[model samples]
Target: MIPAMPKPLTSLLTLLLIAMAPAEKLRSETTTDWPSFRGPGARGVAEGSTIPTTWNADPESETNDGMLWETKVPGLGHSSPVVVGDRIFLLTAVPDEGETELNIAAGGNIDAAKDSGAYKWMVLCYDADTGKELWRQTAHHGEPKATRHSKATHANTSVCVDGDRVVACFGSEGLYCYDLDGKLIWERDLGVIDVSKYDIGWGYASSPAIHDGKVAVIGDDPDHPFVTVLQLTDGEEVWRSDRSEVCERSWGSPLIHEVDGVTQMIVNGFPWIVSYDFATGEELWRLEGGGDNPIPTPFVSHGWIYITNAHGGKAPIYVVRPDARGTIKLDSEEDSDSLVWSVERGGSYMSTPVVSGDYLYLGNSNGVVRCFHAKTGEKVFQKRLGKDAGVIASLLAVNGNVICASENGTVYVLKTGPEFEVLAENPMGEPCFATPAVADGVLFIRTTKRLVAISEPE
Candidate 1:
């Protein structure tokens, strides 16, 4: 008989086993649960699922080919819907005294919305298959600690799930955790997480990321920016690292990835893009220079980490190695060991690019879509989807097709390849700021006023 292993040794071995596995393999193979923003590992790819390419967005249309069901979602929110098994979870903020509207456009407007009142920060769940309301909970209710951009919403961060627990971050309001049955387990106060630009409040949009029984959060407040890790089981603080000096403000979500036997939480910022040790919150690597307004989350793909930002006259796409350390120089030549390949321009301002098959697809806010070689920084093609359609939602990959949703409510589906081929252009009628989620062969999209589930109708 073999001897029993010690608890500490067993835990260490368990971690090693997890670290050895690829980030994609960490998720269950039986069910594709889009538990966070841009899906598992933030890769934005749903394998073995058939996402609908065409659908009728009209509510009263009888010939709805791919329309499954759309349920009315109350209030305004930019938080994308998350999926866990058979339920869909999301966050919204409904004002108690006044109503606010979203300014959906691609122009250069830095004004704050003229709206403020006591809001009910709500957590809502719905049946994934039927689009029926499951339950809703008010996480917090009061006036916001800060204002939001004209194009931003009070609830801009997406919720994340870890099979058993659901977590939502309401910027300065609070962070709350709940069970699958809508039972409140715990909540944490993160103080005033004011994410601003030039002393103007743009509100916070970074979503909480969960990995291996822990949750990672990025609070890029201008005064006290930080990256913190908390226990997902009970919301206890595990570690926190300050970034007041390096980072000014950021709206992107933190990414948790394990590469080269080390797990790191990567964040995007204006002057510095930093990576921290996931377990201890220690600063591991840093890169300088990118778009001034860092709104795109960093993702790992094809054995390289991809980081992109576009604003303030500098649009760059940086592809770095997983084991990079210290401060990497911005002038490093392409194809280098540490810096990999980087381009000075052609990065998206709002949408996060997605890599599928052989090309990486990027969509800008002004309806421009570009495709580049995944391995080499070679531009394949660049085309405009529409005249003024704003593509704010990040790109999505299903099987071999890329889904691009514009601010004008049109969902463009294109076949993945070096050639530019649009498969379909379906309209959603209302504006769409939140990114869509996919799970169990269904597409769940959050428009301005509803959560619509789309699938190929039989």
Candidate 2:
């Protein structure tokens, strides 16, 4: 005889058991999409994938080599590549060498910015499988309206994708959108944005974060700073909130997270780590005593937010707990009701760190890699990368391997745990300033001139 169907309440209980299983057991056993600056949601963690422990991209033959494919892109931009399905999208700023370049050495730890007399901002597409150029769309072309720091470029901000629409923001130049086939949909000229640190001319570099059919941008210009959300379908303004608590430079991109059934937009600023309500652009919560020139992206993990910045001043790493409401502040050296824990001294100068398993790994400007317990703020290990590697690109985690690339072109893979173990040090033979993107066991790394894909031998 056939067994009788389970009752409604019994079926509901069975479904709950499966839903409450460990994440590893219930994770979507599929290759996820790397659709934004630091992959999906900018969490910097790739689920269910194993990247190559060692690989090279200089091979000439197309046979199963370390280099799957390499494509040389025109112009200069530190924007990271985004991958969706079979295509990869990227942005560039072709320098018109005939014109004057705005090359300036304004400060420390950054290369002087150079300007070509005239420039062309472009949106290019490539085949993710073979690195073949699919299409190139020029978004804007003319003399730059704003200046750039020596270490920054015209196209420093990465483009973001939402289904079929791709949005690209060329600070001061304009904000443009295009369909998947390179058709221009809508454009908005937001005027010249004076994004500087202490009135120093550093180019803007914050990428837009797309969520729920809206694009959210955090512009921390010293004059008339504001955070606004726009509708993706028609470029209509949804909401704009003026920021009154910023005084220094912040090139970090904001992040969108759904916490406790409410969507919050979290941004890292000079003196405040602020969270805003996404629906109405209302200030939900704020944290004080942040870095001076914050460039690291605000990292949201589990239910906490981790941020760090250093400008020779209040260089701190703050671990924040959720359930924050209204105004909040924490002492520079003490933990409080909203702060889970904070490190008053040690933090990264640039490059957003990544969390793997139970430990958080950070790589700094001097290539010093450190590990800390994510929950209790316990120190695990601190080891210099040796050779003065000096890491500017952020770190990422792939299947328990913490991937960190240095400025001088070495990708260090470390095992994730309390004890440190050097998994592999893969050198790319070029200066890497942009972060790498991981999808389906492949690593797409952008050096100064080319975007190369690395994967296991086919």
TM-score of each: 0.92, 0.89
Q: List the global CA lDDT of all models.
A: 0.88, 0.80
Candidate 2 per-residue lDDT over residues 378-438, each given as its tens digit = 8888998857577778899899889888776677888889988998877776667788898
RMSD of 2: 6.0
Cα RMSD of predicted structure 1: 7.1
Give the runs in model 2 whose Cα sits over 4 Å from its true position.
1-31, 58-65, 98-112, 332-335
Total clashes, candidate 1? 0
lDDT of 2: 0.80
Query: What TM-score does candidate 2 get on C-alpha atoms?
Result: 0.89
